[model samples]
Target: MNTRCLVVCLAICAGPTFAQHIDIDPRKDVANLTGEQIYTQVCQGCHMPDAKGAVGAGRYPPLAGDVKLASGAYPAVMVMNGRGNMPAFGPMFTDAQIADVINYVRTHFGNAYTDSLEPDDVKVFRPPPPSNPPEKH
Candidate 1:
């Protein structure tokens, strides 16, 4: 057999094995994480380790020295509902987690806004459940 054919055959055979080894649970609860922990685990992936944000295929507005974070509610609403290219994290994170991450970002990365957000504040921004439930066939 040609080397090209052998490589393709090996890849096809190994793909399922590699996939099966991945044990990530998308719904894993993160309710207990601290503000910093939540930011590191979730927000840093896009916003970056330094929280300076990034720009490429999409722009992640820099969290550092951002004037918008002067209003705690603004970041809270953005995290819960998302805007433009950002995805809504309301479904994945609890209200507390959302509040924590927002607070973390607001206070860190050269941002010094001091009014902290409580989980109650974040709860208000969460979208209400759908009025009509989808029926499962």
Candidate 2:
């Protein structure tokens, strides 16, 4: 077999194995990590290290110089509720983590937005937990 074919086979085989190694649980020790750390581990996969998003079958929308960051609430909502292909990090990250990443993205990557987001700010966007119905008599 040619080297190209062998490389392709190896890459395909590695995909699932690489994904399987990821920790799916969101409740890990993420609180102490910085926003840059959180973004590197989570958002950077799609948003890119530069935070200048990508496009394939879809546009990831560059976070750098994005006017949407003008309001801290906007990105917080997106992180929580998700938009388009971006998955919601609401369950995966603590409120502080969400705020950190939001603040990080807003301030870095050539973005000039100065507004800061606190965990309390993010909490506003989170959907209320479903209420349990009264037990049937």
Candidate 3:
């Protein structure tokens, strides 16, 4: 096959595959998702399928057997506020979802912490919205 034809064929074949794997949907409501569902659909993208995390341009900390998860509040705050390179999910996720996911991670992925976070607990960690709107420049 000619080079142009080969490129066209490859693009056609790969298009559907690429589209199928594009799981991140910012507009989709995830409020109803369970902890495991949240982790699989969202967190696994960075943390890896095994929850061992990854390192390349930036480091994604391993959630497996993490000591920080021992304190439910710590992870709850981190998820709400974010730290370092991690993006804040506070605006996107509901308190319930955050609590559920944190609880899930705490129990699974080599972690055995029995203490689970409640949605009310997560509410305390969320930063209050700005009282005044910023003026447009």
* Number of the top TM-score candidate: 2
Please list the residue runs of candidate 3 whose C-alpha ends up more than 4 Å from where it truly belongs after superposition.
Answer: 1-28, 133-137
Please give the distance, in angstroms, between residue 57's alpha carbon in candidate 1 and its true position after superposition.
1.3
C-alpha local distance difference test of each model: 0.73, 0.73, 0.76
Best of the candidates, lDDT? 3
Candidate 2 lDDT at 135 equals: 100
User: Mind giving the per-residue lDDT tens digits that candidate 3 earns over 76-121?
Assistant: 9888988876667787678999999999999999999998799999
> Which segments of candidate 2 are over 4 A away from where they belong?
1-29
Q: Which residue pairs overlap in candidate 2's backbone?
A: none
C-alpha RMSD in Å of predicted model 3 compared with the true structure = 9.4
What clash pairs does model 1 have? none
lDDT of 1 at 78: 87
Clashes of each: 0, 0, 0
Determine which window of 10 residues in candidate 1 has minimal summed lDDT.
1-10
Model 2: per-residue Cα lDDT at residue 110: 95
Residue-level lDDT of model 2, residues 1-137, one tens digit each, is 22332332333335544333443222333446688887776677677778788776556778989998999999999989888777676876679989998999888999877778999999999999999999999
TM-score of each: 0.75, 0.78, 0.75
